[model samples]
Target: MSKLDSLLAIPVLDRSNQPRIQAAVDGKAKPPRALGRIEELAVQLAVIQKKSLPSVRQPQLLVFAGDHGLTRSGVAAFPSGVTVSMVDTLLAGRASANAFARVVGARVSVIDAGVAADLSDRRGLIHAKIAMGTQDASKAPAMSTDQVISGLLAGADIATQAIGDGADLICLGEMGIGNSSSAALVIHRLAPAPLEICVGPGAGHSPEGLAHKHMVLAKAAARTDAAEPLEVLTQFGGYEIAMMAGALLASAKAGVAVVVDGVICSAAALIALRLAPQALDYCIFAHASVEPGHRVIMEALEAKPLLDLDMRVGEGTGTLLAIPLLQAACALLSDVADLKDVLEAAS
Candidate 1:
């Protein structure tokens, strides 16, 4: 069976411990439901682990970097060189993802899934290059079928490594000059929203640039009627986006929680969800991005984000911010004692 087929075969999160998990939470000293969304997060952690007390330890953040041929269509304001340069920032521990991961005590790995330029042998970089970059989807499919499979497996392999290294949760992020455009088109096929609502100013595009980006994305999406998640992915997905989707599936199969970042990450999540609906049971939307269309995708998936920092910078920033909340949720489960302890203390 294909790797995706194996992911499809995995059942939804095991929930036999739900009652025990809730009882543990209720036994805490605090009033019921005081933690708000965090209570739900704790419950999900337990369900994924099949245990009443759950903890999110050694979280892994994988940032896949690629180049998009769609950038040649004048979609993004920045040049393609930024993809390679930012990989340097990540390796040097200077990028936003690194800072956030450091704050949350998580490890970060950078993958060169399909960057157009060559990067030096950086210690933290995972060299999973499938091609120099994706083809210009405005003229042809973004990735060939073989390229898609390669990208997907590369992502799954990273998750395997993280699991082997003992990560209890994973977060997905991306770096590509025109990936936001690819993500927009990916959404166009998966969810039926107006073409206008699907476009956004990624990495700071001016009004004219945004309009041009919309036109480019609309034309790119019009290139295909293939609505199957895989087909839509190859038609408009960047290598990083496709790989991130694969990682989501693999992480779920390992019974690990996946903290999904902003709009681009959400687009990848949508693709993975299409492949295996149960995968959603293991995912946590980190935040609602500044990108307007992110809300549309969240609505389609019925996902409520953990934060609303008005963030759209991507690169897993939102996911890192949400980690503390997950940890707090787990603390309530693991650290808080039963009501019997509370009453005994009072006596």
Candidate 2:
């Protein structure tokens, strides 16, 4: 079978231990459910890990970089060249994501999924370019089905490598100019939502710019009726987005929690979850993006993000912020004393 087929066929997360995990959380010394979502997060981690006491000691944050040709249609306020510059910044450890990763104690790795420029000489950048960015979807399909499969395999390898190197958690991030536009089309098709509701101001567009972007994306959306996850992705998804979807699948197969960031990453998650619905059991939606379309996608996945910071800056910034919460949840599950133990000690 193809690699994508193998990934899709991987067994869903085992839940036989879920009741045990929940009981362990309820047995914590804190008032029952007082910890709220943190308690829920702890249970999820334990169930994903198949351990009553789970810890996220080795967290890896992967920022996949690519470029979208849709920018050629004036769909974005920023030029597409910014994608290359940001990839450099990420590799140089100067981007906001790097700074946040430092604070959160996550090792940041940047992958060149499909940047529209040659970056083969960059040190410390994972080279997995499927193409020099995708083609303009408004005019034609962004990429071929084979390209999507290749991107997915490359991404799955990256995640598997990180997990092999001891990553207990993976946080998804992306950098690609006009990628939000690509993500909008993907969400529009997969969420089965109206194209108008799926369009949003990406990177702060002016009134006319926003209208133009919406128009261009609508044209792209109209070009295809692919509701299948892979087909929709092939028609409109970015290389980084496809890679992120593959990484999500690999992480789920290996039983690692993935903290999905922002609207772009959420679009990736939509594709991953659509392919294997059980992958949601392994995903932790980090935060809601300022992009309005994010809500539509989140609703499609039946997911509520842990945070709603009015932040639009992608590159896994939200994922970094959510790591501490995951760590806290693991601590609650593993470090907190049992109610009986606490009461016995008090007596």
Cand. 1 TM to true fold: 0.97
- Global lDDT of each candidate: 0.87, 0.92
Using Cα atoms with residue i matched to residue i, what is each candidate's TM-score against the true structure? 0.97, 0.98
RMSD in angstroms, all models?
1.3, 1.0
Kindly list the per-residue Cα lDDT of model 2 for residues 227-283, writing each as its tens digit.
Answer: 899999999998999999999999999989999999999999999989999889899
Q: Which stretches of candidate 2 lie over 4 Å from their true place?
A: none
**Pairing residues by index, what is the TM-score of model 2?**
0.98
> Judged by lDDT against the true structure, how good is candidate 1?
0.87
- Give the CA lDDT, 0 to 100, for residue 87 in model 2: 93
Model 1: how large is the Cα RMSD against the reference?
1.3
